[model samples]
Target: MTVTASDAHSAVQTLTQSSDTLFLLLGAIMVFLMHAGFAFLEVGTVRNKNQVNALVKILADFGVSAVAYFFIGYWVAYDVTFFADANTLSQGNGYELVKFFFLVTFAAAIPAIVSGGIAERARFYPIMLATFLTVALIYPLFEGMIWNGNFGLQAWFEAKYGAGFHDFAGSVVVHGVGGWIALIAVLFLGMRNGRVKAGKHTNFAPSNIPFLALGAWILSVGWFGFNVMSAQAVNGISGLVAMNSLMAMVGGILAALVAGKNDPGFIHNGPLAGLVAVCAGSDLMHPLGALFTGLVAGAMFVFVFTYLQNKTQIDDVLGVWPLHGLCGAWGGIAAGIFGSEALWGLGGVSLTVQVMGTLLGIVVAVAGAFIVYGALRLTIGLRLSEEEEYRGADLTVHRISSTSND
Candidate 1:
């Protein structure tokens, strides 16, 4: 028995492919768990009467998102289809399958983010329809433009600014777009009933602080894979990405503590804001730059959340606009600034392109959100009946409660 050099080389190639597949599989699992974070976060934030609805909505949205992505969204974004036989699909040790699983979690987050904004008063089926359309058409169009180079947008950015718009992960592409869309949905849905009366706003206290904190913790822990494993190739992983993520997380926590005046809700969500702001630049910015970006995002969340709730009268339940929309936009632009040679970064970004791309994302998100939610509002209606609102969504929609009183 003898083994040739060519055989040895083939074996090594197979080994590397298997390792890459395994690494991505782990990343996908971690990201899938973030939906649990989304569910629990909404559950703890809404009133007790609506907790069950929150849990049910997140799970249902994920299922719908998976279907949407599998049938149409994936093809729209990547020009790839899964219509081949098992042997063809199983090539690369089924890495594409896991990759789809990974990316679908991101697409599903569109609805999850919107869920937090409009929780407690939305109809179940209407929201489901919105999630399907978003994942199927709206989100994927932009995703294709940015990630897959579908529309020559990246080429235009590169030609104009000497670098393409750089969202190493999906800061502007995923989180920013979701956040902006959620804001529109919240606005179109209007404020929660009795939230304000005669120029006085009432406090809607969280149903369970512990669950909110747990949600934040889960998201924070899983974000390492979210950011670091974005490399998608084992050899491309970097320790710097991990270090920057850590620095940003702590930075967000401290800044939110000071800005929110030690409010537990803000404290828990602070790390998330930081993580959101750091995702775009984690591969390029210095850790200190990432820390600064996180600090700004934390303070921004605290201040903007207060202003929107009190002054503008937008009842964004989890402050999704400030947390994901504003911070994610900031992350996109920050990558350009902090990723420049002048800022001690790796220097492969263009500030002009970043600003342009971020603004484009926001515009697309706002338009899509209004079109979808507005159409729903005018046609079938977006919110529940006044009686349902007072009775609570869990009982009205799900006919159940988080606690089994019966």
Candidate 2:
């Protein structure tokens, strides 16, 4: 049989498409595993009585987030929907569907971040409702603005500044937004019962250090897929992103070790803080720049977490605000700095634009959180009763403990 040029071209296209599809699918699967990291992280940090609730909340939030994002959030962000027939949806080897899967994992992370902050005190159903609202509506608004270029926000930034805001992997879009929103949810829920006594913070050490370490390890491993695969295509992948992510992780570990006074929790979270910061610039930075960014983020998490716990009444369990929110913001700004060619980076970022973009993310997060959590607080209540709290959410909500003996 003779093959025509058109047929040959078509065959090559099909092969490329199939390869890209498989690449994205693997990336999506790796990110999907991060949810287990979130679950275990929360489980280990909260008291033993609340461990089961922590595990349940992460999984439930992911389920709700998938539904919300599929039906609503994807449309809001990319102006795309999956209402078509299966054949139509599966045209590109289901690449688009896997893309949605990858992104929905990010969307689900907002509620998981909030889960840690409000754990042990929040009611289950209300939190689920909040997750639905946030993933379906609030998160996608900013996500569209930055990622999809939906509202001309990126054009405006480029017009005013030399370059548009450049968050290659969602330092602001995901981590920053999640962290700030978690802060507000934590505030609305208030401190857990007996967390403070007469204006003095009480010590609530982690329930399981091994579990905490395991969670951190899982997140760290999966983060390679999270940052590297943001390219979304086989042709677009870069080793630079992988390298920067590694340097930043080590920087965070070492900095946190020194700054956190060798605390195990701080040590574990240090790498996360670094990873969160490097996400914005992983593709643009020199490895050394990423290292410095990680160092700053690691130390910042320890210091800010300590300050918030000691100096303020904000009872943010697991310090999501410090780890994700503030470090995420730093990552955004650091991209502008370390991503500049002057600093041995790839360049094409404007520091001014990054600052503005970072602040905008924070504003959106704070306002959206207030609207969602505040409404929940006023209408159905956001917290468990004091009696329920003392009994722990595992018993009050799930009717099971982490361990049982017959």
Candidate 3:
């Protein structure tokens, strides 16, 4: 018949819990749509004969990551206490809901990146297995540290150096993971066939530039949710975070337009580059600083991808390394440079911490990716059989599956 004051407070907390759940769901939807953007971009970059396979592979990766990670992968990463000062809903099984929502889309992205590199090749099963491993094990380690602090790299840095690294969203965690994985995938799979056959069109042009344009635009749009909403606890920096994201995009696009010789292709990549570049600083950078950071990142991808393709043998499929990996690194560094000491009383973050974060991220991401892919190549093998690679994955994987129907 009587209610205690504790009951009143608990009821209010319960209501707040519902509100957080709704917001988290919204962010999840926005992030999931980014996967669609990746799909369209992959389709635009790959050969037409492989179109069905591209969409199918992406769908499969999303489905696989969702189910596998939810069941066990989330527990492994968040359970270990990757960060010390960072938030971890609880140990063992407490953080499942939050970790699940954040990681599903990230896991989905790895396959999309792989789709570009191993396009027109790679048997369905091998790619699926590889995708599951990367998302299930590789990615969770990175995410676990950043969010849960169980491993406590950030804590160690803060404890030893009195400064800490920050990733406003996940320039390193999400994009860097994908980029590094993409690099390894291509290395193992080798270049696409006819990519360098003498006298052939080695420089495979995008089949649908318009699609690239639209997808790039969508990626840029989706990034707002990726960054602004990432301040999950709401320490009062969301507005500035959103505005900085917008500014960076604008700056990135303009710089790309100026430097890309009026190529819309350059422009599309520019916004993407800008988004990648500003990710670390989305919560910290001043508007002008964000713009500059974006500009630099945009310019790098415009030239870097072209130069790499011309100079090296790595056909990154859709420039994932340059756009996400390289750009993401710059974004992280930009945060320290742009971050003021005043926001959230978090104080001015040091450039040393930012740069260290960037460097550490690059080494770990690239090496970790290479190791997983190499082991797979050595063990089960990462590439498809020569005949399967030539014939296309859709035909190889599906023709057999559909034989009963016909």
Candidate 4:
């Protein structure tokens, strides 16, 4: 029996809508749990005095992402056209679900970045404002360019070349963006109380390694969701992605153990480093390649942290730089290295092009964060007063009770 053209069109449309809804829902859930990961990680870094504030801020980040991404960031970061095609868009997509997961993770990342910069001393309101700008406005633009398949900068790059800036997952898009913003905030905020001396520094303390360790573990778990689900194909390639993600994590752990010749910052950031390292190439790389990438990531984290810590007096409460920035660059470069003709052919895309594309993303992400944050610093005054520093952001900004139970 021959079907009518109108009936066929209707059936196809119905199927397309159904599948898109499923994928959107899946993406949303994966992105949502990332908030739990951020909360644990931030709370762990702080002294007990600030745990309540950290938890509250973390929860607020989720709310911020949910509303901002839905109302604004989603459209800014994602919805656009590729070329001169009027009425063009991504395949069978809807805004609500795309951002449900992607922007949630994006939003959480900003607060995660801020956690290190203002950890022991920041006022909640300023940090919250920065989070909004980073996710709601600044982040959306970069994200829009990267993922907005229609008329984004990334879409233009893909059109010029063969494939888009193949971030398989977001390295520069999420991690690097947050890392730069955090770096800017730290520059304006300066070090915490007594972290520096006359050009030198006094004693530095985590004050709670257990909390840090717990956050690291949660991050490791949540990161699996982050990586595996990024296999947008769900069934076919997800297993390979999961294998690669674990391999990089293992490689990072091994490298960290070795790096802990005497100091154990490697242990703290081991899994975190691996997750960031493989982000660029997770879908493309084999397990062995991911392991090697992870090893490089672990070493990179150690090297960047040691050099930065000694060189600059910046007080990153969570050391987000080594985890996100150094390793994010590694993720992009790894895409160039591990991207293979044997596995997933670039269909003739040059390694140089891939690497350039990745670097281009870095340029955009860093520049965007720097400009917005610099302006925000000048206009609103990024950091709190000296009196507020010792008091903690919880007490100074929100003026809430500080009981451990609360």
Candidate 5:
């Protein structure tokens, strides 16, 4: 055994590629599990009569999203397609495939977010169509502009503001877009039956606190992969991202506890708000800055959720707008503020650019949702019939329930 230098170099290259592939694959798996978190979160929040529908909606949407993203969405966003043969696709240890798997999970989150807002009163098939269209077209448009730098948007931001829009892990691209779109769907569908009767807001409390807590826990755990793995390669991983995520999670929890006054639902969703807010700046912020960002997000969720339900009567179950939409917007803006050298941050961002990008994201998301959902409302329809809603989606659509009548 003679060991050659060439052989050793070849071995190192293989190891590096393998490591990157495995890292992304694991990240994909972790994010994939977040769908279960979405399902359980919705299941626990909606009435038991709609539990099965919640579970079914998340899974079905994920499946449809995969198809849409694989066949069309990925191309629109990145000009990359998976149309080649398997052998050709297997190059680079199939890293591109795993990358698609990972990012598609993010894309699918649009429908998952909407499912919560329109729970208990949506038609399954119509929503599936919406999911397909959203993933294939609507979501990818923003994703491409933000993530892929499509149309020179990022370059334009940098030229105007001395820094490009910086969303490290898709605070605006994924969560914000999903939340705002969900808001449109909720508005278009109107409040659930009996949610507000005779101008009196009725309480539609969560059905299962334990399940809600479990869902939150899963999302919190999986978010590390969601954030850290955005690096998408082993060589780029950062301990800072992980630490920031932890600090933000705790900040959210404590703030929610204080703002929500120990309410179980708010307590559970608090960490999620924190995590959502931290995703954009996790790589660039100090742990303390991350903590502040999380605290703001938690308080925002509790207060805004209450306001929307009581005053606006939006009937957004699980408050996805506050938890994802508003907090995600905050994350995008806070990234530029907290990521500055003056704040002991990494110092490559501009606050002005952040605000512009965030506002643009809001406009794109809200407008896209309005167009798609409005068309659905006008044509194929969006909401269930009043009688069917009273019967519950599980019974009327799925013909099953969380509990056995027998």
Candidate 6:
């Protein structure tokens, strides 16, 4: 059999497509595992009585997010839908389907972040409703604006500031937005019962330090895939992203160790703070710049979390606002500063554009949280009853406890 030039070209194209498809599928699987990290993180932090609820919420939220994003969020963000026949959808080795899977994991993270803040007090079904609304509508709106360039916001930034906002991996888009929205839900839910007693915060130590550490470890391991695979194609992968992520993680660990006075919770969360900050600039930063970004984020999380717990009535359990919200914002700004040739980074990021884009993400997050959580609060209420709260969500919501012995 003689092979023609056209046949040869077609064969190469097919090979390339298949490779890219496999790469993206592996990345999506890695990200899916992060949901277990979320579950265990919440489970370890909340009281023992609420542990089961924490586990249940993360899995349920992911399920809900999958449905919402598949049906609505993907269309909103990319103007693509899965309504086509299987054969049509399976084109390109089903790369588009895996891309959606990878992205939906990110979408699901918003509700998981909120779950930590409002744990032990929030009703289950109402939280699910908020999860559906956020994934299907609110989150995808900003996601489209920044990632898909759907709303012309990126173009406006480029025209005005010399460069568009450059969040290579969504420091502001995913972590920042999720963190700020979690803040709104925390506020609406108020402090957990007996969290504060006459202006002094009560000590609610983690239920299981080992579980907390395990969760942190899982998230840290999976984050490599999260940042490195954002490129989404075999040709676009970079070892620089992996290196920067590593330096930032260490920087965060060391900084949190020093600043947090050797507290285990702070130590565990330090790497996450660094990872969140570095996501925006991992592809463009010098390792030193990434290290500094992580250092700042790690220290900032300790200080801000301590202040919010001690000085304010904001009962942000697990400190999502500090870890994700504020650090995520700093990451957006840091990308502009660090991702410049003058600063030993790859150039093409603008400080003005980064600031503007970060603020826009925060605004969208805050507004969306208010609209979703506020409506839930006013209509069906957002919290468990006083009796239910004392009993814990496990018994009240799930009809079980973390331990059978109880």
As a whole number from 0 to 100, the lDDT of residue 216 in candidate 5 is 91
lDDT of 4 by residue, 185-267 (tens): 77767777766677776545554667667777777877776776665543434777788889999998888888856454567
> What lDDT score belongs to each candidate, Candidate 1 first?
0.92, 0.93, 0.74, 0.69, 0.92, 0.92
Q: What residue pairs are clashing in model 1?
A: none
Candidate 2 lDDT by residue in tens digits, 343-383: 99999999999999999999999999999999999999999
Candidate 1 per-residue lDDT over residues 1-406, each given as its tens digit: 7999999999999999999999999999999999999999998899999999999999999999999999999999999999999999999889999889889988998999999999988999999999999999899999999989989999988887788888877888989999999999999988999899888888698989999999999899989989988899899899999999998899899999999999999999999999999999999999999999999999999999988888887999999999999999999999999998898999989998999999999999999988999999999988999999999998899888788882
| Of 1 and 3, the candidate ranking higher by lDDT | 1
lDDT of each residue in 209-261, candidate 6, tens digit only: 89999899999998998899999999999999999999999989999999999
For residues 1-406, what per-residue lDDT tens digits would candidate 5 score against the true structure? 9889999998999899999999999999999999999988998899988999999999999999999999999999999987789999999888888899899989998899889888988999989998999999989999999889999999998888878889999888899999999999988988888877788888788999899888998899999999999999999999999999999999999999999999999999999999999999999999999999999999999999999888886889889999999999999999998999899999989999999989998999899988888998999998889999998999999888889981
lDDT of 3 at 88: 56
Name the better of 2 and 3 by TM-score. 2
Clash count, one per candidate: 0, 0, 12, 7, 0, 0
Give the better candidate number (1 or 5) by TM-score. Answer: 1
Worst lDDT 10-window in candidate 5: 397-406
Pick the lDDT winner.
Answer: 2
Return the TM-score for each candidate structure.
0.99, 0.98, 0.87, 0.84, 0.98, 0.99
TM-score of 3: 0.87
In candidate 6, how many Å is residue 182 off? Answer: 0.3
Backbone clash pairs for candidate 2 read none
